[model samples]
Target: MRMSIGRRLSLLIASQLILAALGIMTSIVAFRRLTHETAYLRHYVFEPFVVISSGIESSNALFDLLARPSSDVAYDARRPMMELRSFVEQYQRDWLTATSTLPEALHLRAALDRAGELGLLNEELAAVDTIAAVVASLERTTGLVGPAPTAPFLRRADVEDLGAALAKLNKINLRYMDVAYSAYDRNRRLILLAFLSVCLAGVAAASLFGLAVHRAIVPRVRRMVTAVQRFRELGTYEPLGDWGNDELAVLAHTLNTSFKAIAERDKDRDRFLAVAAHELKTPLTTMKGFSQVALNQRHDAAVRDRALAIIDRQATRLARLVQDLLWCARISGGERPFNPQAIDVQELARRVIGEIEPVASDHSIRLMPRGDAHILGDPELLEQALWSLLVQAVSVALEHEPVLMTIDADSAGRELITIEVRGGKDLPEDLDRLLEPFAVIAFEGRRGEPRGTGIGLHLVQGIARLHGARFSIERRPGDIMVFSLELRR
Candidate 1:
């Protein structure tokens, strides 16, 4: 699919934003996980250890009171014994609550069950119950003691049993702490690893994306820039290679098309200058030679007259050539001044025929006048265009051949007037080429008359355009070359 430059850049930016968002989300999730883990260690591990340690202290005090003589018991043993029982109960409740409330703890319990080690948790709870039972038994034994001095109420066997239960509970609490610490350590490492992996993946992805985008866009831009710079410095266009269906590609195509056109124009300009120089040189050379001959004192009167006449004719041809070149320049520069007014087409044709008749003495110029037609146009430019057509027709016509000029209304019922010139000669097969400036047309029956400057028909075409007329030439029946102008009435 063809993507424009705008869309490509937009995608690049959007992808980068998406990656950044992912990284931020990963950070946020990792932070929440670590925070939960820290809370679990405090609630379920460290707090339980403190409660168990306090219970052990209370148990020791009770045992010591029982061991002392009843008279030496200054503090109330009942209060201490009751406190010990409450501590053991609170520890058991807190352990169960912490495990149930924490998601991590629940997952750990499920995992332990899967591993066939579910009794690990049950053992801890049972040990807490056992300690509570032993404390309640001691509390009852102490209450039964009389206020008078007596021996310790706890039997020796009961004291040993209570010590063993306390020892087992402490051991269980230590095991639970080990399990909590081990899980925390393992989880902390895993979370850190996941966070690092996400960060690295994001960095890698961003780098690759940047590289891909740079390769896609930067090199193509650089190539276009280089081509423009080279053309500016050397006046030569180098076409760029096709990249893809993107904006840069379209720009390259447009630049290539424009460069090709400029190159063709440059070629045409060079060819025109060469042809123009030759055309101007020819008449000037003739005038120079004839003027030298006429100035020679040794020449007879008749010879001098002949030389002067030749010089005059060449000067006239030179003047006409210069005029045609100037007209072409003016029209091309869009500076040709137009003075349009209503003109009688038939009268204008007669005036043009009269002017060209003297110069085309070898060819008989005839005007086949039809119904009267009038047009709104620039009189001088229209006259010049008609004169060029007539001159061109006469130049190619056989000696004494009839050259026909006609001005009439269009037969097709359209509000148009056609001015036509037909000569008894075949035009060049490439008739369209003649419309271009300096396109030479070589007719088969042309005499020794000087070849045309070739700008005549071009000027005629330009003048016709300025007057909003259509100018064309074609071969007709009877091998006649027809030059035509169709203008609005």
Candidate 2:
């Protein structure tokens, strides 16, 4: 299907916007996931490990106090027991706070509990509490007022058990930290990869779209440019092939139409020149031959006078031909000025009949006036047009036949005046061609020579047009050819 330039550009823009939106949305989703994972590691993984390590240190300190030999062992153990109890309470608070802040951490804790890791850590914490209880009992039994006692209250086995529990707890925390760190790193890499992939896809799509647009526009534009250049150089039109329904296609069509019209006009111009040369040459040749005979001293007076008369007639014909050529040129160049005034159509027809009747001796000229009709026109141009039409009618009419010039108001109730020249002979089938400059309707005169310079009808048409009148030719029922001029009243 055909797409306009505007629609194609709109589609390109829309595609780019859609791709950009998709990229932005992908980035937002990936970033959101990364942020969530970060919070998960901080609360459930790193924070919990810190609290476990602190608990292990507090356990070690208690064991150290138990290992020392002292005169008042209970008094020394009292401070370590209080510190261990405080550490245990603080560890529990920290763990609770971390787990409570993130829902994902709570789920992780539940999973760890199912795996026995959380339970093992809890058991180790309970052991530390038991050791603190033993130290408390010793302090209660050996009062501060008693004499210095050297007996150690915490046994070697108890210390060993406490160390083992703390070690196990630390090991569990380390393993959990490792797992959390691995996952965090993996998720971050995945997010980064996804964002990069989305960006790459957008870039690829944009590149493809750019290439598509270039292919759609560039080749056709180049073709049109090439066609124009070829026409400029060769004076010939080359058709740009069908390029679908686009702006370029429409332009190509217009150029094709204009080029064809120019070509036709050129043909017409060449034809006009050929015909004009023939018409001008004939009259000039006649004048030249007769003038040569007239100038010869060997010629008698009667023969010389006859030759002079023929020369004068040819000159007059040549002059008329020249005048018609000039009028055609002026009309075509838009150089003819129109001076409109009300002119009686009947009176104009009579003047044109009088001018044409003397020359057309073989044919009778008649005026059929319907009424006193007046039309607004350039009087001089209108007269010339009427004279030309009458001359054309007289030349084409059969010998001894009447050539009628009819002037009246339009029969169609329109405010128009119509002047018609009717001749005894039928018009050529291609009557319209007679309106073209130097176009002749083939007809033989009494001497078997062609009558009328082809310019007469063409000049009449042009003059009628200058007065904004309609000129037409048609054949009547009796094979009578009629030339009509309809002018606004």
Candidate 3:
């Protein structure tokens, strides 16, 4: 059967559409995933900076508290105070340079504040010890412990006030530390939540996209591959199904059309080769053999007559090939010359069956015809078609098993007839090619069996085309092979 151009085009369009849709889908999925990943990475980088800034704020408070004398400690307040200042200064510089993501660092900008309550209490402890020592010195020298020398009114009121001020600084540090840690903890959770959401979204989207791709696109592409394989190995054309109206579908359709067309063209080439070979083989064999025999023998009258007879037979074979070639050319050139007449297809099959019955019996084959069918077609051409089929059936039948040809009308007087031709159980893998002319299985240097020019079926195909019918060959179980002929008027 001929595949129409419009159908081919639809298939092509469908294939391209399928491919394009899949490409677009993949790009979308990749882009989304990349964007989400980038955001996740950026969030990860900013978390460290917030942590370091909080450390700098705590160190500065300790430095200021040591600068004052507290009348409490035996240690030298001046030297300790200088060391504290140096440490605070170093820490302050570290704060300016530290690379931390902690939010508290951004919030706590000011520096060099006064000492806290702990510093004041420590200063008081130093001053009290110093006073006790001073009183002891006076008692030892002057036998009096009455509040050492001058600055006497500098009393405990001084230490108490300094302690109160220090307490306030400690409270400030505690408050800011609480705020900073709280912000960091909350922000950390927020970042964690964001990342989790992004990851989940990416996973979900990937799965959805994968499902879409497998469901809508992969099978269509796989079908194109299967179709190609079947065409190459089996000489069969299978149409690619819809992948949807999407780009992938279009691609699948287009590829299917290409594969089918390619298979058909290949089949045509094989057919032409087989038919041409088979048809040419017979006449060449006869002509060569007769000419060589005649040349080798003395030309006696009887021998001459026999030579002429053989030559004539070969000439007839040549004529048949030439006629087939011409007929094929005409058909190709659109010279379809089948004029429909009211005729019975069943009658034609019966007639052809009768003509070939003796041939079938000679081969020990059974040829049966059964059906009630009428068709508006060229009876001569149609009969020839049936005859050609029966001849091949008898050729393939074995010595003992009878070949059976069954014909039955299909549905509503539609003139549907199936000729089930039974023959050898073993069929050639290249069965269709076998129908061609000189493609017979000949010995290396001799004439082959089933002698005839192979144009018989070529003629049948051309005539069927002229009548706008469809012809196909298929195999059945055992030794049965069937030819399906659909004739429509």
| RMSD (Å) per prediction | 6.6, 7.1, 17.3
lDDT of 3 by residue, 49-69 (tens): 342233223223223434555
Query: Which predicted model would earn the best lDDT?
Result: 1
- lDDT (Cα) of model 2: 0.68
Model 2 scores worst on lDDT over the 10 consecutive residues at: 413-422
Per-candidate TM-score against the hidden true structure:
0.64, 0.64, 0.36
List candidate 2 segments past 4 Å from native. Answer: 1-17, 27-103, 106-232, 235-260, 293-320, 356-363, 387-402, 410-468, 475-478
What does candidate 2 score on TM?
Answer: 0.64
Per-residue alpha-carbon lDDT of candidate 1 for residues 1-489, written as tens digits (9 for 90 to 100)? 656777767877887788788778877887887788788778766776687677777767767766666753434576666667678667665565324555656855754555456677777666666776676566556653335334436655655666677778778657666666677777788878887887787777767767767777798889888888888789798988865688878888988898887777676567667766866897789889978887884458998988887777667667766877888889889998998898887788888777666556667777776665777788888877777787677666655778777666766522232333344344457788777775665444343434554577899889878977788877767666778877776
State which candidate, 1 or 2, has the greater lDDT.
1
Best-to-worst order by lDDT is 1, 2, 3
Per residue, candidate 2 scores C-alpha lDDT tens digits across 138-171 of 4444443245445546555655665575566566
Model 1 accuracy (lDDT, Cα): 0.70
Candidates in order have lDDT scores of 0.70, 0.68, 0.52
